[model samples]
Target: MITAIRRMFSSTIGKFLALAFVVLVGVAFALSDVTGNSTFGGIGGANVAKVGSEEIGLGELRDRVRLAYNQARQDQPTLTMAAFVESGGLDRVLDQLIEGMAFEQLATDMGLGVSKRLIDGRIADIPAFAGVSGSFDQTRFQSFLRENGLTEAQLRRDLRQQLLLEQLAGPIASMPRLATGMAQPYAALLLEQRRGQAAFIPASPFAPATDPGDAALQTHLSQNRGKFTIPERRVIQYALFDAASAPVPAVTDAEIARVYKDNASQFAASETRRFAQVIAPDQAAANALAAKVRGGTALAAAAQAAGLAPSMSGELTLSSYAATTSDAAAKTAFAAKRGDVIGPFQTGLGWVVARVEDITARPARSLADATPEIRAELAKNKANEAIVDYYNTIQDAVNSGASIEEIAADRKLALATTPPLLASGRAPGQPGYSLSPELAPLVSQAFQGAAEGEGQLATLVENEKFAIYAVKNIIAAAPPPFAQIRPDLLADWRLAQGQKIARDKARAIAKAVEGGQSLGAAVAAAGPNIGSVQTIGGRRGELGQDGQPVPPEVALLFSMAQNSVKTLEIPGNRGWLVIALADVQRPDPKSIEPARVAAIAQPLAPAFGNELVEQLAAEAKRRIGVTINKKLVDQLRQELTGNAPVAE
Candidate 1:
């Protein structure tokens, strides 16, 4: 729960803006070419690439990459910076940056422009700029800019560039319409069917007869060390305490009396009103709806009959309701008595006709009547403060060289130790082990800290609970001793040998079938251990009863040309299968209905638009030449991965 709350909190206003900013920059941000120039060596310095006259600075590249990495980490908690860089994430971000700049340059040269008013509207629409009243606040917007190290001018410039790019590409990439005549062939392809013969060669049947010996097992283990290696683990010592264990301050009657006196405005009488209303496009419709309601027809029924829906507004004070609707509507609704039908007044939404459904009135409370509530509130506040004080005392003890056990003894709390576990809190070699809920959050933090028993404190449940913890031991990730996994290694080696043999046999069968031999005869010739050839068939668009995808082998058969024979390895080293296509049947285009063609064409329209936009981007890049600084790019990658040598 703590981890989940942290993730939720980490998605801040800046992250929200980054998400929307990427969309404004380009639609193909994630789809940027990962296979771009990777040999980083060039004369360019500081800048990653030069798009026309504009340079994409290395700083921008680094910031974008870091932002993207952080955003990606929200979904993938275990994703490491090195792994993200190695997985083409850096390359893709650079490509997107280059492409966005290139397109902006091209659009500018073409005289496309975005107005300041347009940029203002875009900024105002972002919910992050809204104040507590849920309206866009200029102060909030300016503070966000200051926090993100951005000026208003820079924000507008970015917004302008994005809007210009959208104008340049929007029409071409917008909803495209494909004709039925053009879509029939694709529809027919989906209806195409194939029948094939497949024979399974089980790997277990081909296991080696002799023992591979300990030496061979050791060699295999050395070659495949990564597969057997464990991640770094830590033994953690922690002590926990909750609000229930903390002392609450006593509340006196005088204190409660003082609170009521100092905060007398809170005890003032208040009124809230709820209303049922229907908005119409025009005043005539509004008048008619009101008349119908007054004629004893239910407001919901009357509105629905007129092709509208009636909605109930939540109970709100007069000023709040005025802010939500319009002052005129609020005044009319609030003036009427309970169950009164009123309003043919104009609101911000439209012309409104409303019924006063309910009114809730709260009378001022006396000191004695409010005493219980005030006392409870005071007690809760005092308890929270006590918990925080307790937490600080424990933290101070930890900082003063007290071990978790020593601190627990001083505080009179229980001290618990976790088994050596990974950052995810799973004990190595103990799959079923789980940390108690209170201790689970500490493991992640402990793994992030030094393993020298440096004490730290974490608020596990905010003021309600907290834990003090330290890493007791560090277990470096490595492969276990040879004797520890010898049996497992031997079994894996046998499986590997069997898979290799099965693969060879499958290839032989495929070769024989391709060389003008019957699939059944080829399998029979291979050995009696091979499963009998089974006929497999599927339509290209076939789905299982549960709507699952067609099996991979069947899909492969449909993709193959007639008379083609191929071998497919089953997942998990289960076996290999030799597949031979016997026949393919494609439905006649004329047999496909126009409706079917339309259905196929609808989804393809967007794909067609995307292809057109891709072509447009290529042309833009050609016009506004892109030059990559290969050396600096390579340096960036090395820096990100910590592979760069330390300076002397």
Candidate 2:
């Protein structure tokens, strides 16, 4: 009971909204998340909703809904748009869109301004723009913007709204403290239990006596086509090339000599010195310490006498040592001869005194001595330049309307063709087949449409490897022939017919109970196929104890009014359940253990905070004034499912 409530109330609105934004920008490359042509064939573009003076366009709403669906498909691969919409996915997207629009307007009305520097910091923090070194990379950032079809201004506007939302709602939803008295009632509610009587109406016993005609079965199959429909698959022909394939440029000796000459300072004679140093709390103390060292008191002993320890500065060059300490400190330490005491100049650590211990001098290297190092550097630079030139040549070939096969032939590159693959990069009906990592992008682009003859160029592993690909064939998603699936279709038709009969019977039983007939009598009247009435009683929170979700019929008992009966369909069309709530038990607030109450209260605090933020959003909406065009929203949904043409 405690576990369930804690999980339910732990998250704040701030984290929730932040996660929503992350989904939008993080998967910028998943442009094909919404499959099929993006062209809105006929429907005209118009505002779906208006929040304050800002209008929410149909295109924006469509894009957001597609994004939400894509995120959901990560968990449920076969989830359909119809099912997603039925499950309130569209409404959730609409609500989030309306809330964002309201908040942005509210922030503007309040004169809140987000600085460019703050927005830059946020953009830099996004992992999508991070490079191999895990820092912001300008090239990667720009590439993402181009691929996602977003302008810098649009991105900044989104980030600004997000920042404004955080400023407005973050404080209200910050970690809160819930009073023990307030939490006591909630904790006591966990102890409350419900008792009910449940009767199962097995659908199999109610199955049709004979198989339906072909016409009827076909109608059922057509209505439920998504169940039998295969996903679209495509075959791609492609050629790949990597940095290894690029020609290596010859490095002349003159180039190596030039590099060696340019870095003369690096090969010059130099010395690395090590020092023993002590830091004092102040300049006067340091001066006294240095005086002691100069008077034949060893630096370590003098520092120890003053209750400080002497530390060693590792071997460092003049410039390197200056980085660690101050410039003046490094200069003074190096200027002193070996075994000489140097004084009392200010450093970052404190007022310091130091003694030089050792100095190792390195002789200048001749051209022959530096040849190996300089040669390696020049070769690496030449190789990189050659690779860049190679890539540019391939890109230019693609831009000049060369086919994948033609380009491969011209460049002497090897070509490979892929087996038919789904958008998910898996071969349809071939369970054991594994997709090559390099071919995944080829498959994705093929389905999106690689132009005829010319094909498409895609980077397989960023700058290191690339592929030019074109779609060879495409198999669109559709139901298999009716004859091929007749047996399964017949079984489905029978079960569906059985479910309809079971539903009618369950409803009659529920009606009988409402008409003052005893639940057992109602069950008996429904005939022997009905399961015997059984008493069911338990705490509501214990319904999901076996790792599976609570049965809907059982869960409904907790929410139903006492002495009321309800009928619910069993999952998977197995049967129906007639449930009657017989009794309700409420525990006293004083009965809960204080420790448990505290545990429950801790999570409940977030709920209170979330509510405050929700209220803030509601207040924003009220101030801003929102208007929705229901007709356009309905048309947009139709367009999404291809039932209606989309407007430009």
Best by TM-score: 2
Best by lDDT: 2
Q: Once superposed on the true structure, which residue ranges of model 2 sit more than 4 Å away at CA?
A: 1-24, 27-43, 67-71, 115-156, 175-182, 189-206, 235-237, 251-410, 415-420, 430-433, 441-463, 470-476, 501-567, 577-598, 642-648
Candidate 1: where is the Cα deviation over 4 Å? 1-185, 234-266, 269-362, 378-417, 437-476, 543-550, 588-591, 605-648
For each candidate, the alpha-carbon lDDT, in order, equals 0.73, 0.75
TM-score, per-candidate, Cα-based: 0.63, 0.72
Shift of residue 271 alpha carbon in model 2, Å = 8.7
lDDT of candidate 2 at residue 171, scale 0 to 100: 78
Q: How accurate is candidate 2 locally (lDDT)?
A: 0.75
